[model samples]
Target: MKTVYIGTYPPRRCGIGTFTQNLLQAMSGKDDSPKSKKGFFVVAMNDFDQEYDYPEEVGFTIRQECQRDYQEAAEYINLSGADCCILEHEFGIFGGRNGVYILSLLHRLKIPLIVTLHTVLKTPSYEQKEILQRICRTANRVVVMSHHAVEFLEDIYDVPKEKIAYIEHGVPDYKFLQQEAKKEFKLDKRKVLLTFGFVSRNKGIETAIKALPEVVKKHPEVLYVVLGKTHPHVLHYVGEEYRNYLIQLVSELHLENNVVFIDKFASQPELFKYLYAADIYLTPYLNEAQITSGTLSYAVGVGCPVVSTPYWHAVELLADDRGILFDFSNHAQLADILIDLLDHPEKRLRLSRNAYEYGREITWPKIGAKYNNLVKEVTAEQLKIPRKKSIPFDIKILPPFSLAHVKRLTDHTGIIQHTKFGIPNLKEGYCLDDNARALIMALMAYKETKSQKALEFCPVYLSFIYYMQNDDGTFHNFLNFDRTFVEEQGSEDSFGRAIWALGYMLDNAPNDSYSQIGKYMLDKSVPVFDNLRSVRSIANVILGISYYLKNNMGDDVMIERLRKLTAFLVEEYRQNSHADWKWYEILFAYDNGLLPLAMLHAADILKDEEVRRIAFESMQFLSDITLKEGYLSIIGNEKWYHREDTRSDFAQQPVDAMCMVLMFYQAYKMTDNIDYLKKLFASFMWFLGENDLRLSLYNYETEGCFDGLEREGISRNQGAESTLAYLISYLVVLEAHKNYYSKYWQQNQTEDLTSNE
Candidate 1:
């Protein structure tokens, strides 16, 4: 089975890149199985603004920080006919918080995936842990280099043990002549101690430099060679400060003659020759947190006598006298160990012998064979699990309808406005806008699935609306948990949303008691309609009046109220709109599609041709801006699209997606246009990861949705408004599938037959 490798690739100057290149080489020409020809290629990751002349084997290249590139790369991999994908996962190599942008690619992949983790921190940040856990969930098998990482995955990350495969870092399979390599480097007369790989402050090179002076005092011919360039990232930002400091330290210690710096990224042959030339390998890493050190692995694989700090990898690799370890930053201890090993030729030979014996098991050929078998196994297992039909309109991919998260957010009072993660953050108290949304969501949930829990909460949310309304027909937006209003009056937006909830109840209420209560609240709010100046407020009031008229079509007073609201919305569009901008406002802000959604509702109820025309035109305008990419890119709240300014691409709110879904569904319902139905599905998919960042905002684990899509990643906050928006969109999509999709197709079939006749 052919495999596509996703990671940084040569000649990118990244350790992960080198590892991937080596793995690809090892696995090449090894596929003899009949299932398919075993082969490998790469999907190289390019750092920001840095490009490479990649080889033909690199099927695709993904710019690290460009989010769309990841999705496109996944598409390329899927179409490449690769049976399985192996990803080299490192936190810093990919884009977004904790390298979350990789998730988009991983999620879209159709084949089995195996991820080899390069770093596994014991105490990961919130985003880091989330990203890793999500990665583990997506991968068929997770590979880690060290046993400590396997335990960390199980104990800390809660990954299933069965899903983890421990694979040691592979080393080059080549023989080296130490004496000849030493002579070639002109270090044959000296005792050579070497440290290689990208140099950075964290490597503790100064500790080794300080220890060298003491070692040189006893063995005057001792030489310490520092190899590899400064870490590219550190060099880019800090500009060789650490490297300069190390040079100065060597000079001040009067050990300049004993220390030499080789600042180049060595090829494998060159690195292996240097490894054999050294009597000892020094890894003075300052921390014990390193789960895997490729340089250290290479040193051991070459059978060099190793002197290193007790980093996690060193401790495990040197447990059985394979190498010696010293305390971190304790140069004196390192010095003593070095002097003893240099003096005792037999002891050094024994360490080398033990390391070589162990290294044989982890040579590149053996490690490559293990990975090849794993790929075959994962492929066979993947074939056993029935695949979902690859149809865009399949509703089978939708999560089962549930109100568990909504119930978690709601209380006896009402659904809480905000949550920290999935837990309700009562400190934020409650808001009328969210409660109004919660009421509509609950009604739709009950209407679609007849969920008893949804019907049970309808009264609870309606009660919140009742408690927030003032005697004067205005409503207080905020309320503390103490059940007291915190404001005298709410924004026009909140009041309009309250009307929307009440009107929706009048139309789709489960019983007469709810209808009476909704009618009572909506009738009292009608007097405040004339005062609604915000275009959003007028639009929302129109939707409420239209829904109300769905039940009481002959209510002339309500019809007049709807006409006045529609007129107000139309006048706003007439004043602000031009040949270029077909919107009801000067700029695209939050809930941008609401205006057209309201217009559609008014046009359907009024049966006015001009109103219907404008409604479809504005809906198309919104669709052009948001769905031009064939997926919803909600107008971001961060510096929204001004009349002539570029549109900000992040901080995409869920409410905008929900509004588009509603508006398009309404348009499809009126016109039976299949295009609108497709757009509606795409808008709903924004929650499921088809947006700019391509990260799903809906949290299936908690059944709650994240607040929005921000520049860094999905916002961690799962607030009521966002969750309600997702649930409402989900219900609407289901409604379209049930009431429109099959019928539309059947109607098309009938039209085809009629034309033939």
Candidate 2:
């Protein structure tokens, strides 16, 4: 009995073994045939004690043995061959450096050895070069499926030209194999492009994605089917990194509607079914090999029109009469091909039929006869023996980070705000730059209208920004966007915004339990306080607000730290700080009110004259940053990021509503300066209500947040948030009502707004 093993057998579960088993079954069949000499085959160098049924037809046998020694096994198999021996040689499955043992065994067989080169190396390694050279010296015949490969090896290696035999990879014959059905839509309507095969790094799935815009315009239905996952061995060189890179590129390009990545394995029959569904088959591969294309063969075998890179092997297949050979280096050219192919339907059918005609001639019986001829010739020859050993195999499996300690992880959060996605924690695959404005919009809407949907975005935004805060409060740039949903913690400014949002949410929310949770989490953190600008500013800000809300100052250290932070704000915003006063003003104004509240608490506790000075100075910046227009101007150049028509759209201008809110309350408490209070009140109403209450709802947009306008008769600006901002705007007008019963407001909307409260 002779055993030939291919895939991982018995104990190991692998795809290649499954393919090999099917191949064996096709050769052996259900009933034993006297004409066939095929027997139990374990083609593997190392055999597991366990045995797995081939599931091939029947009457088949497997001769198994432990390959303690490869060269010895080769000699034993050769001596016992009683006929011939075949070895399946692929650079990936067999050990690169030790792969020569397969050839050495062929040498020992001398009776006749036919080696099937499973893979043709486009980028052959040093060990691969050495093995190919040794195989050249030993094997009586080499079987290659590609003609280009015959020429390539002839030029690259010292192998005899006549010694190599070419037999195309086989595909099962099926109906619809030769038919190119009229597209559901007009042939020119859309491009239903398809990609099926192992998805590996160099396979360049992204190239196809980048070309989608052009394809879609020509054929709107240019749907892409990324039919299968990758070969296990392919990941060793490329790793799972490329898979992620491709996914992000797809998202960034907004191809979610056109591209469908089916990360599943398909059988031979299923593969054909998928191909038949496509308008054009795409193989935008970066690498070209002379050897073989299992996928291309399948596509062509089923008469699918293709658009592929002009690799040496691809040239051979299509040079005769197949499909278009394009430059793999140019992305636009590849996309253009797809566009052209989708536009020309009859042309595609003509080429597809021609390729399938070629495929049909490649029957297993003919291929087996080639093998028989090689074996006959090899057995007739005399040869010397060589010694070698068995090979090892391994798989790539990333260790899982079980979220078993989710609470343990969340426990590290400074304030248990909410679940954040696509924010500061990078949300893995979600792009922060893409969502920053959206994030801000979501938060502002949450604050203004208090909509459930808007408020719900709070946890998401907080989680997005907070996950970046490590134990030590530092941030990373990248995170596992897939396996790990949240990734790198980014810049300080990003964190600061997140921190401010968290504080604002914590301060105003009616939820007391969450407030307590925030205080606790902050307390348990890695004791990060006024250390760095990014870390300290935000940390102290949270603590100051937390102490005020909880009415609990744990220790004097925190109180002192808060004072120092207030002092830093004061010094940072000195009248001559730089740029415009507004930049410093926004930060100062933001810190001013909270710091004053902190200072007020300290004044009651420490009785420090310095604390009183800082509190007073903090409140003073509001007046300094105010413009003559009764509104606080943005910091720096107002024209920096605005359209001419969109006046008062200061890119860095200070926010008038917030400044007025702070100043009006302060003036009311400070003295009988009713004028200051009145001014603050008028500014709030005029500035906020001037836009027709436009800024009220945050003018929601398509970016999944309240960012821009609601002009399409769509009341995007209405929600929990619109209600909140309106509520605040209404409060100011109410306060000024007692002083001035402005006839203009009453003549129109003012009376109704006033009555709203």
Candidate 3:
């Protein structure tokens, strides 16, 4: 079975790059025939602007920061005829914040995936933890070198234990040549102490350097060799500052004769020679968080007795006298341990014997065979599972309807405008915009489910709208929890939303009392529509007026009102819109889909073909921009996208996603097009986890949706606006499922019964 590996490869100086090259070599094994190499290849990751003269096995190259490159790389792998893909996952190796851009490629892969996590932090940043969790979900098996990493994955990241595979870091298969290697490296007369791998400040080389003075005083013939070049990224950004400091410390301590810095990357044969030459391997890493250390593994594998700081990897690898551990940056303690080990040659030999016995299990060939087995197993399982020819146009995959969050956010005063995570933030208080949205959501829930609990919320949210309205019919936008208005006049958007709620209630009220109250408020607000200039405001009012006309078709005054509003919106489209830019405004901002939705409603109400034409044209434009990726990537609210500017990818808000879902639902209803139904479901899924981040914004635990998608991660606050938007989109999808999928199923059932009769 051929496998494709995705990561940094040889000819790049990165540690992960070297590891990939070694893994590929080991997995291909002693069979050097063409059959062994057939169809097995590497998709190398290039650091920004740096290209490699890679071997033919490197099938594709992804620029670290170019997101499009990752997508194209996946397409290449999908068509490469490789049975499975193994990804080497290191946070900084991929592009975007915490390397989030890799998700795009992972999502597109058609083959089975296995990801080897090189680093698993005990305490991770929000983006780091979320990105790792997403990767775990995508991979069929998550490989980690240390058992500590496995525990972290299950406990910290919540990855299932069955999904995780504990595979030790592969080490080179070589015999012990401590004295012979010392002679080959020309250190036969001098006792050698070695530390290797790409040198960085975090390696805590100074502690080892500082410890050398005492070691040399005790054994003047000792040679402390620091092998490998400075880390490439560190060299690029900070130059040789870290290397220089080590040299300076050695100079100040007058141990320059005993200490040596071999500033170059070693070949595998040479690296093993250096490992064999060592009396002991030292990895004085300052942080205890290092989950896996390949350098340390190589030392233990070669039977080189190791003395290292108690990093997570060392603690486990050195446990039960396999090796020795020293305190981080504790030079005196390290020095004392080195002296004792040197004095007792038998103790060092015993440690080496234990290390070699343990290393036999993790030799590169054995580890490679283990990986080969995992790949075959995953590929076979994938082949056994039948592939679905097409996605079903139904809600079978959608989560069940939930209003637990809505109830939590709602008090007698109405749904709170904001939340601190899942809890309602009283300091932010209530807003008419959210209350209007909440009212409409309640009405949809009550209509869809006929739940008395849902019906009960209608009056609560309706009461909030009544409380926010001024005597002039204009509404107050914000209200404190103490029942005081923050503003005398609300924005046109809030006014429009209030009208939408009232109009929807008038058409689908639970009782005559609600209809009477809705009609009274809607009638009082009629004068505001004539003066409405904001396209979004007019669109909201137009939608409300159309809903009102559904119950009052004979009301020509309302009909004229609808006609004038549609005309204004159409005129706005004609004036500001061009062939390339088919929008009511030059810039696309929040709640953009509302514009086309209003026109669609008006077109159906008045049967105006021209209005319908513009609506469809503009809706197509919106869909082309947002749904072009085959998933809903909502227009971000960060300095909104203009006609000629580069569109921002974030922060994507749920309200925008909700608008898309609602608009597409309307489009499907008008055209009976299955494509619209597909787009509608895709937009709705943006809440569940199908968007840019691939991290679910809707928290199932709280049943509350996150506020938005920032570039770094999902905004943690589960505000009322986002939560309400999620519910509204969810209900619309459910309604569509009932109307289309459920109805179709019922039709099939009826035909089956008739045939039996």
lDDT of 2 by residue, 227-299 (tens): 7776555664667676778789879988887887787776655666677766678787886753566677767
Q: List model 3 lDDT by residue over 1-757, tens digit each.
A: 7799999988987778878877887888655454666668999999867999988888899998887788899899988888899999998888877888899899989999999999998999765787788899999999999999999999999999999999999987866457888888899998899999989989999999899888888899999999989887788899999988888898899997999999898888898988888888899999899999999898888888999999999999988798988888999999999999999999999999999889888988888899999998898888888877655255776777889998898898898999898898999999999999998999999889887788989899999998888777889999998988888898999999999889988888889999888888888888878878889999999899989899899999999999999999999999988979999999998999999999999999999999999999999999999998788898888888989998888889998999898898998888878788889999998987798778788886788899998866678899989999999998898798887876668889999999999
Best by TM-score: 3
Better of 1 and 3 by TM-score: 3
- When summed lDDT is taken over every stretch of 10 residues in candidate 3, the lowest stretch is 388-397
Q: Give each model's whole-structure lDDT.
A: 0.89, 0.49, 0.89
lDDT of 3: 0.89
Superposition error at 467 for model 3 (Å): 4.5
Clashing pairs in 3: none
- Report RMSD for candidate 1: 6.5
lDDT of 1 by residue, 113-193 (tens): 999999999998756777788789889999999999999999999999999999999998878899999999888998899
| Model 2, residue 721: C-alpha shift (Å) | 82
Residue 425 of model 2 has an lDDT of 34
Candidate 1 accuracy as lDDT: 0.89
